[model samples]
Target: MFQLLIVDDEASVVDSLADTLPWHEIGISTVFKAYSGSEALELLKTNTIDIMMTDIRMPGLNGLELLALVRREWKRIKCILLSGHAEFSYAQQAIQHDAHEYLLKPISDGEVLDKVGNLVGILQRERDESRHYERVEKAFQEHLPKLQGDLLADLLQGVKISPERLGQKLESLKIAIPAEGRFALMLFRLEDRFAELDFYSLSLMEYAVVNMAEELFEDDFRLWSCKDLHGYLVFLVTIAGEGDTQQDRQEHPDRAAEPVESRLQSMASQLQLSVDRFLKGSVSVLISRWGSFPLDIKRLYEDILLSMRKQVGNQSGLLIYASDELEQLPVHALQRLYEPPMLVHLLESGDWEKTHDKLTGIWSELGAKWADSQEHLLEAFFSIYASFSSFAHKNGRQLTDMIGPHLSDVTGLTPSRSLEALQQWMFQSLELLQQCMENETRNDRENTVRRIKLFVQKHLVEDVSLQAIADYMYMHPVHVSRIFKLETGENLSDFVLRLKMEQAAFLLADPSLKNYEVALQLGYQNPNYFIKVFKKYYSLTPQEFRQKLEAVEEQ
Candidate 1:
């Protein structure tokens, strides 16, 4: 439905049109009558007028002038001019002012309905097109992150694409990095503290890290990031523009004095500190040297991975930069041992089969490449030992509890003495650890649910929010919600409401305590709202419920 405004200098003409015309039949739900052009303008300002029919020879602000002003302000409104004369000059002025129809003052109601109906059809078509475009835009925005991530991941993995296709993809994905721009790579590995998180929590932490990077680097660089195949977050960064750099220099004199590499190093250090302080986790950062984009991306990724494996060691929160002058490690640095889906991550995820395969692959590589290198054997031994020990401690146990005293007691070089002995110990320890974890999974969930219930009951009148419960349990709120729902077959929020309502019913049984007093006891600030909730829960108002109780007791 649309709105229509009828204007004329004569009051009778405006009233006749507004009252006698079947405007509703032509989809005009509202017909506004005005005696002068100025009154029509006032109506247009206050209401959304879709079609305007005005007399051409009004006293002030004539029809053509009004049409011109409406054209400037509300371009979508369709205007029709009414005149007593059929002069060509009047028609020419109507056409010049973009009027939809130039009708004589004694025009028929049928003609008016026909013209207004046509304008309504045009408006409906435009509205449909606009809604369709809005939906498409919304869907594209929702999937834009995944689209950008897929393109970046493909480029980093060296998928073959012509420059034209790559450029098209970049433009469509709205990536600001130039196709041939000079860029550098930054690789991040979440340390042991992050690795202990469940898969969902870990993904959220990775997202947080990326968001932090965007904030810290957005001033000087365009950053594109994705989680690579090796379970590491990779950021492809390029300088935004020379203007931005100059502006940054003028804004921060202290930072401007340092070289680009030094500034980046400082920012990376800040990122590490932020993660540790806010997220309660540590991350190891590796920044690669600058190289040409597209051509050097794959090489830089590989170099950074190699550097991380050789230099990161078992340390937590170490930041290293790739430099040409850095010392090269030994030729055989145990590639498969530090490869994607590392043993620790697999164990943390409880993928025992993959963990077993990972161990076998590491031993196979050790035998093929560095059979006689005792240092390599010990390196593998300690790495595997630390992963197992960390997993045990994470579950509130010790390595000795899972693998028995014999293996735990062997201090120095005993376990890594031979390939056969190390393999035996590794397999045996993996079997025992898998058994322990499987047995403990159910018990762990049950215990977590029990603790959550106790905490909610204790703080039933206090904050009992999800975050408060998670803090008390030393868990993420999402993790806590998931665990409670999985074990109890009910949402935590529903459970809390059920408890509150049940307690409200119990308190309502006491006549000495008023409804407001009971609401306060249950942490509800509004007694009326409490009554509404009680009625919703028990199918009766509190007063009625008390009456029923009294009747039952008298009976």
Candidate 2:
């Protein structure tokens, strides 16, 4: 409920207003009366006054003076001025003092009530907006972990953020990890035992796992944990040593190493034990070698992801430390095949010769250095096979369908154990891809043309933009337009216009419709443009076409 104060030098005016105004109807429960401005000031000190209505000419403390004092003391109190004189200076003073209303002395109760009602609305709105802000702040606090998790996930997925900008973000999000501190990343993968659970239950289990991790490492390190892009639980861990700054710790590596590594290993074991005991799930922890923050994070993530790939289905419940001697793969070795316009993209676009040449470049580079190593050979094989499988699957075919009986020999590590066998398998797979692209390209072009025609027919009276059609087919418009022209021997734009004109001709056969009405029916807004287009297509305007049709029907 809101409270109001009525102040005047004349006690009758104050008393009349206090007793007669409909305070409760406009959400005001109590009205206080004061005979002078000083009395009003005293009332303001004790009461939560929402509004104050006062006579301007009070003797001891005038209304404008009282309002100025109130503005200093209680800024929230909305003031209204009442006076016998209609002086320009008085109204100006009232407005300057931020009074809500200025009325001459003989104001009606309705006028006073209306002004107060508006002020009450302002107060209520302020309260509502304030409450909404508070609720939003509370929600942000509750979901801060998830937000931080998403940010960490993006970072691990190789999304770049500058160090200064990243530090600002960390400060704003209240994350405690230092921007340049040395840290380790760990990947946690849940075993088959917990895989059958629903997503929500699995999420709860993951949250519990993070909480257990926080508890385990809270004493020795700062942990920023999140689910990485590939659904692995990833943690960026920094040591929490006392009395030493990050620079100091970096300078004194000998003192920090033994204790920190031992603590991390111990904590990993405890985390696994806790999950096994409480959640009946086993997780493998793959820990990366220590690296500096922000810059090294993406590279570290890639290294750990490769490590995790090696232990799939064989190393559950194990804590594997990434090898310090492991060399970082050169950018061209893996990045070319994984990035855009890579082998898969070229194959999808039926660029057979380019796809073959790209693979040859990758193989030539790898064979130069790592040809004899079995592990390196397997990595190369899997990389090529995975990209091929992904492309084949996208084109509604399987890798087995392309490679046929040779799939088993290529996939088996024993047969492709030698570098020569691996090379042969790689080239053999490329040969098969080229052949499949040859046949699939023909079928795919036909299917694309059919789908485009169907889409055009379906959207004849609506927007049939080339980009929209390309989006529906999930290909670039320029590419689709080229393919359409190759397959249909006509440009896509010409096809659409022809179809629309044919539809317009069919609609023109109806005798009851007007020319403008038929243009609108064909999705054209300007009748003149529509008529010109109709003449260009059929050698007759819409009116001439309709008249010709009527003459034929009568004959």
In candidate 1, list every pair of residues with a backbone clash: none
Across 280-366, the per-residue lDDT of candidate 2 in tens digits comes to 989999889899887788778877877777755466788888764336445224543453456667777877777877777667766
Top candidate on TM-score is 2
Stretches of candidate 2 exceeding 4 Å from the true structure: 1-132, 242-258, 324-555
Task: Give the local distance difference test score of model 2.
Answer: 0.80
Report lDDT per candidate: 0.83, 0.80
Error of 1 at 422 (Å): 3.9
Candidate 1, superposed: residue stretches over 4 Å from native: 1-335, 344-353, 363-383, 386-398, 411-421, 434-452, 467-483, 510-517, 543-555
TM agreement with the true structure for every prediction: 0.37, 0.41
